[model samples]
Target: ITACYCFGALLLVVASICDLVSSIQLGQDSGAVLSRPANSSRIFYGVMFDAGSTGTRIHVYTFIQKDPEELPVLDNEMFHSIKPGLSAYADMPEMGGYTVRQLLKVAKKTVPRLEWKRTPLVLKATAGLRLLPSEKSQALLEQVQDVFDESPFFVPDDSVSIMNGTNEGILAWVTVNFLTGHLYAETRETVGILDLGGGSTQITFLPKSKKTIGSSPDDYIARIDMFNSTYELYTHRTCIKYLLCHVIHRPPYIIVLLYTPGLEWRVFKSSCLPKKFREEWSFGGLTYIVSGKPDGESYVGYKLCYQEVLKVVKDIVHQPYELKDTSVFYAFSYYFDRAVDAGLIDRTQGGMLEVRDFKKRAKEVCNKMSKYRPINPFLCMDMTYITCLLKDGFGFKENTVLQLTKKVNNVETSWALGATFNHFQNLKIHR
Candidate 1:
């Protein structure tokens, strides 16, 4: 029995190495993400599939345990993403599974055949599936899980599901702080994270004062025991895209709109849109005709746009008291993408920006409606939304600096790493 157990643990180590070394497909064959020293005795791999609102991404991580008493050290990460998230296939369950199956090829091709049975496979869906009704989202999740079961990798029963919005923020906060070494350092000081997605946004931070948590809603405060310390994180989850649904259709259209609850006829109008712009967009398997007024040319700029979004954000968004005193944060996802689009930051390497910077860009983009490309009618609206969401919604000061980045240490600074860590954090298998 002891020999069999020892052999099983050894197999797990080799299986993990197969997945990690195999993820070197994207021109990183010569990179250090996969190379390990001769003295390293133990290695493991973790596979996580993030089904986001915009797309699905896979993160395969390899860690080496140098000492039995210490935590495993991260050695390499294999990352790849696909477009049209699982939500895009809410209606076609089998098609959604097909997308996961396609990405799974990378894993199968790389993971050694002998170790395939030992590697763990999991998928966590975000805003895309959250927006879906339970039945539809469950069907989509089941499809992906079925694909996992069909593969050679190990599939845990509680593998595929829609994550809670707050947990999403917390895990992202974990990813950034852990990568930056703040989580492991002696000082507990950690940076906050602002994640903006097409369908949703999450704000999470470790408060320096209890007043911040005391004054906020009960649900806003969450406790997490990580490593050896307990952390109380202040998190807020909001969906900007949910508000976008209202203005999805250009005003003065008499057409049936499709939604999860089924089709409903309604004329959606918003002051944020241009007065004469018509656009068609698709997200989460639904098509929307978004446009400005067909008849009138009205005033559209920062002032009016802020007020329009303020009505929806003001009372609902709880402001953290410590925000003004200490405001160190890392903003990513659509925040980085739009900042690049607006020329506020660099595309390859992200930079720092003040909350007022977004306002300045918003003014420039919103005032020049004609100069603004008709292809992205939402640029002005999106910029204005970020500005309002920060200043008016979260009560962030104008001078608050947000470090925008897409990757940290050559790995995506999203929640996937954090989720992977949570999945394979501590192991005590006898070997």
Candidate 2:
């Protein structure tokens, strides 16, 4: 019996060595190898997909094994994203389907050679798909599933699953914190996160605690005060229901008649204003008036000053025609008239309001607006939300660490999604 046991142990050791050899050989072919002890449990790779309103993002993470007493190292792993801007679908719903197809195509092309299969892919769709009509949303999901079915042609078999918003927020929070140097002890006392995207923004606040050292905490003391006092107001915007109604030309409309002679103003009127204000004040030709600083640097002081610019633009929708030449005047007037008739702008507000000196008015408005405190601090928290989330939510207790890896900034062009699918398909679960 003792001899038999010894033989069995020898066979097991040989099998382990063979597995390591195979992994090393595979790594050599792939140009990169993540080496670790055979019994290490701290190493893991997480691939996350963020389908935002404006685009889709795929992030790959590699967690390195570490001593229990030392901080764990996080490698960049990889990243990719897609951008069509949800606005493409606002006017035409069919464009959403096209956008998804394009996104899948790009995702398939970017996976690492070795990780083309066996990696787990987590997909989370945010504002864009969430705001789409029920029928459209269902169609979008079906299209995504179909694309996954066909992805094997480009890469190979892999697992893909959708993630809830909460999870996306959590993972994003983790990633951001890891990227930024915020995974330190002092800064971990309390942290706030704000994620701004083309369509909507997500805000999260996490308080500090030491209970999450060894195991996941069952209960976390939420910093509700931080959320209510700082985050809530900063992220408010017109609801989707209101935005959709405006786009479809429903009720509760306001119009603005412009007397200016430039097509540039139309672009501003059409694209700059919030959906609520756009619906409320359908702007006219004078909408593009270049009154306040032709260089676009006039309003810099106001609380959420960009929003003030939007409001100022909306206010000028319907104003008296000023430039010379009746033909020019008619062009401006005709466009303004059409805009109002099309339920784009409102034509009220006493006669044409004109500011003779734009620079002076800009200074005055900026001064007054600057006095209002910004709802959220724009500096430290600008791109720091993701970092805050990881540290607070995922119990990432580590000092600052910099990771270098391949990253795709333009998700729309790169095939990150497909690459992610292929990564998981090739993964070999050793445990």
Which lDDT values do the candidates have, in the order given?
A: 0.71, 0.32
Candidate No. with top TM-score:
1
Clashing pairs in 1: none
lDDT, model 2, position 296: 38
lDDT per residue as tens, model 1, 26-94 = 212334373454577766567889998768988877666543433355677788899988987889999
Per-residue C-alpha lDDT of model 2 across residues 1-431, encoded as one tens digit per residue: 33322222111112232221111000111212334444544443445555655566655554443423232334334555567643335545456546655654443554444443433444556555665676665565555556555544222233333344443333333333323334343434322333323322233334322322222223212211110121111111222221222232212111121112465533323111221122122422222221222333342333333342233233222211211111100011222232223223354311221112222233333443322113211211111222222223222233312121121121111223323323333343332
Question: Total clashing residue pairs per candidate?
Answer: 0, 47
Residues forming the 10-long window of minimal summed lDDT in candidate 2: 322-331
Which structure among the candidates has the greatest lDDT?
1
Candidate 1 error regions (>4 Å): 1-38, 240-265, 268-271, 280-290, 293-298, 425-431
